[model samples]
Target: MPNTNGILGRKLGMTRVYNEFGQASPVTVIEAGPCVVLQKKTVGKEGYNAVQVGFREKKPSRLNKPEVGHFKKSGGTGYYHVREFKVEDPKIYELGQQVNVTEVIKIGDKVDVTGRAKGRGFQGVIKRHGFSGGRATHGSDFQRQPGSIGSSAYPSRVIKGKKMPGHMGTDKQTVKNLIVIDIRVEENILLVKGAVPGAKNGLVSIYIKKA
Candidate 1:
C-alpha cells in the first residue's frame, strides 16, 4: 500500500494515552474513514490530478438530484461530507473504493490536519488579534480600545491587511507535522499527538505531510 494524498475524517475530540515509556501523551482522536472514493480527476481532463472522497452517511432526501445521481453512479448512498484531495497518481484509485486510515497512515507518521477553527464571533482587538489592551488603572479611559487605527492625513485611510477588531475564528486552519500516536483499524480511529483545529465532531482532513 503506497502513501495516499489524504483522507477525510471526523474529529472525535481529544484524549490522553500512555506510551511504552509510561509517559502520557495528549492526543486528538479522529474517527477516520471508511471513506468512499467518489471520483477521480486527471490533469488532461480536469486540469489537475485529484480524488474526490466522501465521508459519513447522509439521507437520500437530503441530497439534490445531481448529488444523488453522482453518488449512485459511484455505488454509494448519500454522504454528509465530500471533498477532493490532490494526488500524484489519481489513476491508482477507482470510484467506489473504500479508503481507511491504515492503508495510508500509520503510527509515528506525521500528518497535516485541516479544519475550521471554533468561531469566536465579533471580538475586540485584544482577544482577536492579541493586542495588549490599555492599562486598567490610572484613570485609563482608553482601555480595551483599538487605539490609533488611522493616522493624520498620510495614507488617509485604514491600511489594508491591518489586524483590527472584527469577526474572529471560524477560519480554515491547518496544523502541520502532528505525529500520529496510534491507530485502531478495528474502530477506524486515529490518535494524533497534540491539538487540532475545529470543535469536537467537526470535519477534519488528515494528509501525510509533504517532505
Candidate 2:
C-alpha cells in the first residue's frame, strides 16, 4: 500500500476500449490533474496535516466576493471546486504551486472517487428503493406503493429507516478501489475501469487509497 495523492478533475464522459489481450474494458474518461494548490494544513497549527487543492479555472466575475478574496490570499486563480486530503506522514506541496496528475498516480493504481450523483426527481418505491416491478395485467393494483407502512396494533408505529418513496440521486457518494486503466500526461486525463459514480461532467474528488 502507498500514500496516494489526490487530484481534482471533471468527468469527460465514458467510453469503451480494447486492451492488449483484445479484451474490452469499460472506462470513465476523466480530465484530471494540473490542479493548483489552494492551501495546506500542518500539525502545529491545524492539529492535523492535509493539502488543499483547487481545479478548473473560471472568470472572476462568476465567483462571489468571499471566493475571490480566498483565491487572492491563497495565490490561486478562480476555481470551481476545492478539496482537502489528509496526509499521514508529511506533505511537500506548497501553496500557489501546481500538482500534475502524473506526479501522484501511476498506471494500474487504485483510488477512491467521491462526487455528487445526478438528481432524479421525486420517484416511487420501485425506482427509488428497488421494489419489485409491478404486474401489468388485470386488477392487481398493489403496484409500486410503499405498502403497509405501519401495522394496526402491536408496535403501531412505523419503524425508522424503513425504505420508502422519496427523492433519488443528487446525493454524495463514494466508489472505492477503482482500478486506474490509463493515463495521458499531455491531456491530464485518467481512464479508470468500471463506473465512477455520478453524472457526466460532475466534480469528483479522487484520492489515493488510505490504510
- Measured by TM-score, the strongest candidate is 1
Tens-digit lDDT string for candidate 1 (1-211) = 4546889999989989996899998999999898998999999999998989899989887899899889997894889999998888888887888888898897898999999999999999989988888899989898889999877898899899888889998999999999998899999999999999999999999989776
**Where does candidate 1 stray beyond 4 Å?**
1-3
RMSD of each: 1.4, 2.5
**Residue-level lDDT tens digits of model 2 in 1-211:** 2232688888878998897899999999998878887877889989988877788888888989888888996673788878887776446666777888888788888989888889999999898888885686798787766778887997899889888888899898989999999999899999998888788888888887654
Clashing pairs in 1: none
Supply candidate 2's per-residue lDDT for 11. Answer: 89
- Mark the 10 consecutive residues where model 2 has the least summed lDDT: 1-10
